[model samples]
Target: MSVQQMPEATVPGKEYLTFRIADEEYGIDILKVREIRRYETPTRIARTPVFIKGVVNLRGTIVPIVDLRMKLHLHDDPHYGEFTVVIILNLLDRVVGVVVDSVSDVLKLQQDEISSVPELECAIDHESIEGLGSVAGRMLILLDIEKLMSSVDMGLVPADA
Candidate 1:
C-alpha cells in the first residue's frame, strides 16, 4: 500500500504492541505481530548491515532479526537479559523478528489519543513513522513496520529473498 493509503492517526481504537528501546517507547500494529520470543543470540551473518542482528531458526523457518535500537540509531548497548524480547512480525507474508529492550503491554489507543507526526526533517526517518500516540502521559512512536522493514535501506531481506 502507498504511504497515502497507510494507516494514520485517523483510525479509532487501534491496538498497538508497545515496546521499549532505550528510553523511548515504540508501537507496532498488533495485527501484524505473530508472537513474542525471548532474546537469544542469533547466528550472525557475514557482510550484513549492523542493524540486521542475524537470523534465528524458528521451527525450521529462518527469520531475520533486526535490532531496533541499532536501526533507529538509539546508540545504546543492547542488554540481552531476561527482559529483552524479540517481537515476531508477519509483514507482507514475510516473518521477521525485532529485538527490543522490553515489551510494555498491548494498548488500545483511541483516535483522540493519537496525533499526526509533526512534519520536520529529523534524525528519525519520517517515512517509517505512522504517528505519535499519547497515553498515560507518555508518547509512543508508532511505526509502520511493513514500510520500515521492506525499505531498501534496511537490507533485512534480499531484493529477491
Candidate 2:
C-alpha cells in the first residue's frame, strides 16, 4: 500500500517504537519503521562522518546505517553487543537504518501523554525533537525521525525533500 494509504493502528492512540541509545530512551513514530534487524558490520565509506557507520546490503537495497549513539553523542565509546539492532526506516521514499543499543516495546500514547520539549541548551538538534512523552513514570524523547533523517548533514535525503 502507498504510504498515505497504509492502515493505521487498530487502537486509537498513536504508536511509537521505543529504543535505547545509552541511559536515555527515545521513540519514533511506529509508522516510519520498516523493519528491525540484528546489527551487522556495514561496509565503511571514505570521507563520511564518523556517525555514519556505512552501508549494508538489504535484499538488493543498499541502506546507509547511522549509529544514533554516535549521531547524538550519547556515548563516547560505542559497545556493540547482542542487543544492538538496526531500525530500518522509510522516510520520504528513502530507506535508511539507524543503530540503537536495543529495541524496546511499542507504545501507544494518547495526545495527553505527550508534552513539549523543555528548553535546553545541548548538542542535539532541538528541532528534531518532537516532544517529551511520559508513560509509566518513564520519560521518552520523542523524535521527528523524518526531519532527523532528512537533515542536511545526514545526507540520506535531499534537504528539500
Candidate 3:
C-alpha cells in the first residue's frame, strides 16, 4: 500500500507513554501499556530481587511489581509517595506492573524527533534504550520495555518463554 493510503497508526512515527523517574523523563511504546493503577502494597515474595517489590492480584491474575527506581538503580532509597503509580504492561503474553515516580503525557513523535542514544556507561542496559526523543524542548529516554523487562536479570520470562 502507498504511504498515503496506509492507516495513520501505521505511519512512520509512533506514540509513547511518557513517565518520570527521578528527574529524568522516560518513555515506552504506548501499545505495551495495559493500564495504570494507584500504588498499592503487594504481597512480598521470598528470594526475589530487591527491585521486585512483590506481586499484586489483578482481576485474578498475579502480577509482579517492579520498581523502576530500584531496577535501574536510580535511587538508593526510593520513596513511595502519592504520585507513585503502577504501569501495568502486557509483555510477551504476560501481565507485569512497573512502578514509576509519576506519569507524564502521551506524545506522538515522528521518526525525526528521535535521535540515537549516545554510548554511556550506566547501570541501565544500553540495549534497552531505544533512542533519545526530543519534543518541545523536552528530551525523553525512549525505552524498549520488553527487552528491559525480559532480560535474564529480570527473571520475568524464561529463555524459552
Candidate 4:
C-alpha cells in the first residue's frame, strides 16, 4: 500500500542474491551481503527467539543468525533438508547473518519491471520487503535489511558482539 512496494519504483536489472525462506523466493541487495556461509554450530544465547540459532564468529566479528522462515511468519521447521542455508548480510552498515531455507541464485530486475504486492490480509511485516522482482517467470521478494535488524532488536556491533 506504500510507495515502497511499487515494483516499477525499484531499480531494475540490478543483480540481487536470491534465496528462499520457505517456498517463497526472497532477495537482498547483492552488495549489502558479504558472503554465503554454511551452517556451523554456533554459540547459543539465552532468552532469544527460538528461530535465532545463535552467534557465529566471522573472522573476529560476532554475528547473529536469524531464521528467515520465522521472520517471515512461515513454519520454521523445514520439510526438506536441502533448504537450510545461512546468508550473511550487511544491514544499515551493520553485518549480520540470516538463516534461510535455500539459496536459489542471483537475479537481475530492472525498474518498471517489478510488481507491487497486491492487497492481502496476510500478517507478513511488509516493512522488511521492498517489492517483488521477477525474471523469466520466476519471482523474488525484495528484502529491506535495515528494517530486518531493527525488527528483531539486534544491533550491529562495532567489531564484535
Best by lDDT: 3
Q: After superposition, how far is residue 156 of candidate 4 from its true place, in Å?
A: 6.4
What tens digits encode model 1's per-residue C-alpha lDDT throughout 1-161? Answer: 65566555655589999999988999999999999999999999998888898999999999999998888888746768789999999998889999999999999998889899988976567888989999999899999989889877778657775
* Sliding window of 10 residues with minimal summed lDDT for model 2: 2-11
- Candidate 1: give the clashing pairs: none
lDDT of 3 by residue, 61-139 (tens): 9999999999999987889999999999999899999999999989999999999988889888889999999999999
Q: Which lDDT values do the candidates have, in the order given?
A: 0.89, 0.91, 0.94, 0.74
- Return the lDDT, model 4, position 42: 72
Per-residue lDDT over 1-161 for candidate 4, one digit per residue giving the tens place of the 0 to 100 score: 66655455644377788887766887788888789877776798998777676899899999888776766668856443655767888776666788876788887778765778776766456776778887788888787766766664443333343
Error of 3 at 48 (Å): 0.3
Q: Report the CA-based lDDT of candidate 4 relative to the real structure.
A: 0.74
Candidate 3 residue pairs in backbone clash: none
The CA lDDT at 71 in model 2 is 87
Quote each prediction's TM-score.
Answer: 0.87, 0.90, 0.91, 0.79
Say which prediction, candidate 1 or candidate 4, comes out ahead on lDDT: 1
Stretches off by above 4 angstroms in model 2 are 1-11, 159-161
